[model samples]
Target: MRRFKHLFFLLLVITLVPMTSCDDDDDDVEPSRMDLLTAGEWSGFAIFVNGADVTDFLASDEDEPIDVRTWKLKFNNDGTYTIRGDGVDPSPLQGEWEFTNNEQAIILEGDSPGDTQTVEINKLTSSELFLNMTLEDEDSGTSIDGEIRFRR
Candidate 1:
């Protein structure tokens, strides 16, 4: 009985020793969806609609449109976002933003929040953010393919 008890104790210790061992990665938690978003500032690089360049569409009315290169978007860690540029009303379009569908989609809800448009994330990296969205022309009721490209 004594030998049996000692063997049992040894087995138990062996099983638990590895379980409690110090791991270097104990504090290295993978970044969350929100963590990746708030990491940098994104500048509008280009816009395409129905395979057509529309980056200058907003410039049609201006004699000399402010350079669109200055447009910037900053995602806050607090579930909020801000976009400042020549076209964005109020300078900064402050509001909330989130990732859905296991972070495959992004939705931005700013002032006058209407039906949330789920934009598909084409590419999301430390230096770039590419998104695709579909918008319907109200007059034609035809679906239009659109893409928004940004860079950090």
Candidate 2:
């Protein structure tokens, strides 16, 4: 009877060991959607109208440029975004945005008609974030494929 009791106790511990070990690993699990969105502020450079670098546009004060439209983009943890440029009003252009998932994508709706933009997040860090986006314009020939790198 003593030997049998010892075997049973050992088997019980073996079964419970795995369960306890799993709990330890739970702390390393992925963060929730809101947790990720609230991680930090993402600010970076952007180009609009294709073929104009952000700096060139800013330098020329919205003069015709090449390869990108110059602007600064800010994304906040509170679900707001801001865009500032020479020819545009920053306040009306700034608004709320939401991530499609915990992954790299978000939908931004502006305050004006036909002002919505969809951004695909490329990378994010403590001090910077990168994104790829195309503006909504059917008349334009070339698609606005570009990268935005923002600093905190």
Candidate 3:
């Protein structure tokens, strides 16, 4: 009777094993980059144009090198962002920002439509944000492709 009971128990265990399932939905889900961008404020990391230093232009009328730490960017949950200068320039540019191209690019809208830009996101993390923008320098009358990096 004991042997028969053991045999029945083994059969029950075998039958239950196939009924068990493991869920992986959580593991398959990817965290959104937009969520990370809106996580906190970020400061300028670096700015380059055509493989040259053009960050001096980031400031409006400053003779000194712009202190990157003073520049700020804040992305909000409402799909809006704010850009501020470090007082590094006499007239620092500040404006609104948004994600476009299905969240693949960021559009920084200046006071006028002609001053707006659509930048591709190279990388975005809790601590770092990298972007590439093609811009036309109204003063220089030259088209420029630039890379801008920021850090938290």
Best by lDDT: 1
Give per-residue CA lDDT, model 3, range 11-86, as digits (tens).
9999988777565664785558777888888888677877776666665445444545467878787756667776
Q: What TM-score does structure 1 among the candidates reach?
A: 0.64
TM-score of each: 0.64, 0.53, 0.63
Quality of model 3 by C-alpha lDDT:
0.74
Q: Across residues 1-152, which tens digit of lDDT does each residue of candidate 1 receive?
A: 99999999999999999989998788888777576678988898787877787777745536435334668989887788888998666787787888899999978887774945678988887778878987565456798777878898
The whole-model lDDT of each prediction reads 0.78, 0.62, 0.74
lDDT of 2 at 83: 71
lDDT for position 68 in model 3: 55
2 versus 3: better lDDT goes to:
3
As for lDDT, the candidate ahead, 1 or 2, is: 1
List the lowest-lDDT window of 10 residues for candidate 1.
58-67
